[model samples]
Target: MNYIKKTDAYDIYIEPSRKTIVIRQKWKYIWSVASGLPNWSYLEKKAWHQKADNVIWLQWGSHFVFWALVHDENNSNVSLHKKEFNLEFDIQWVTTDQHWTANVKKIGASEDFGSKVNPSDKKIYLAHTDVKRRIVSNINQNTVKHEFGHTIAVNDEYGKLNGNYYDPIYVNDTKALMNVGNELRARYIRDIKIKVNKMIPGVTFATFLDK
Candidate 1:
């Protein structure tokens, strides 16, 4: 594996034996808002900052917020089927009740399902039931993780329009992160690959699914 790029939010590496490109994205939530008021550390809460529900600057970084990382190893490597090479997400989630980096909000149990507002939307709306057990357990449920997939730009794969978006050859795949499953498919990492290529000049990796 050859290291390609490194940033506060992610790191890139190329693994030749498996013909896979790796992206290790840091799961820290950086929340900062310029305020006329002084930075406030809410003693009542574990999260301390300038004090507000909203933030003007929110991004992924490793230094600021210290939260335990939860790994989704189920979805972090290229599949071994048909010699197909594709990108995959090796996400490291920092554990905490509050994720200032993600625009995740809790909705009522009456809601039909958890959803990411849009393809490029950073916000995620998850039903309260999906998050209740995860609060203290530190183990994220499938619903919560599925919505998290959207924040990184992976589209849904259940419908006719979406299945072809990533895993074009997949059928009723229910065990992957975006397809209401926990196991990730190869093409799910397309967006991340595109982003990486754009960031590093003279470097391009083909996503086998696109071929």
Candidate 2:
């Protein structure tokens, strides 16, 4: 079997100022105002999960809406790492939790399922309608990145460390950031391809939904 060699990867840079906005907007979109403030660390660990949600949302609304991200300041501390990875964006730097109910109310989702008033039992909960439609109606690209990344984890047999490897290594193959390594790489083009293949069967490497 031939391994999918990384291709068409490009460096991504977010001015420190814009990075914060992107993260916040994405969180706002994903968690929704109804979901209230999100845990930053939780977002860091599993941000890619937001992608499927965003795609679903786009399918439903087909409009770009503003999203605001709030962090729980009581326990918020994210690092600013060099975006040396192949990915063009980083959602790890956003961490602030000001209880803002207005945003959630604006979307008519105030009494919705994930409101702070009634947080979901699941760590990450998607609206059933959105799931049924195979779309995420209110989240953004970054949120999708955060949430989908969570699904790629597997425990190590030796119990050494929490190896959050997205791309698992094969026999005698070196670990790649797109595969199983700590650092995010500049290879999200490959990452997205992998996710799309899983989410929509029969998708080829070159196929992508129109933006």
lDDT of 1: 0.42
As a whole number from 0 to 100, the lDDT of residue 178 in candidate 2 is 21
lDDT of 1 by residue, 27-49 (tens): 43332223342332434122321
The superposed Cα distance between candidate 1 and the true structure at residue 181, in angstroms, equals 1.8
Native-structure RMSD, model 2: 19.9
All candidates' lDDT scores? 0.42, 0.27
Question: Which regions of candidate 1 fall more than 4 Å away from where they truly are?
Answer: 1-114, 128-141, 160-171, 206-211
Structure candidate 1, residue pairs in collision: 68-95, 176-181
- Name model 2 segments beyond 4 Å from true: 1-87, 90-159, 162-191, 195-203, 206-211
Give me the candidate number with maximum TM-score.
Answer: 1
Sliding window of 10 residues with minimal summed lDDT for model 2: 98-107
Consecutive 10-residue window with the lowest summed lDDT within model 1: 54-63
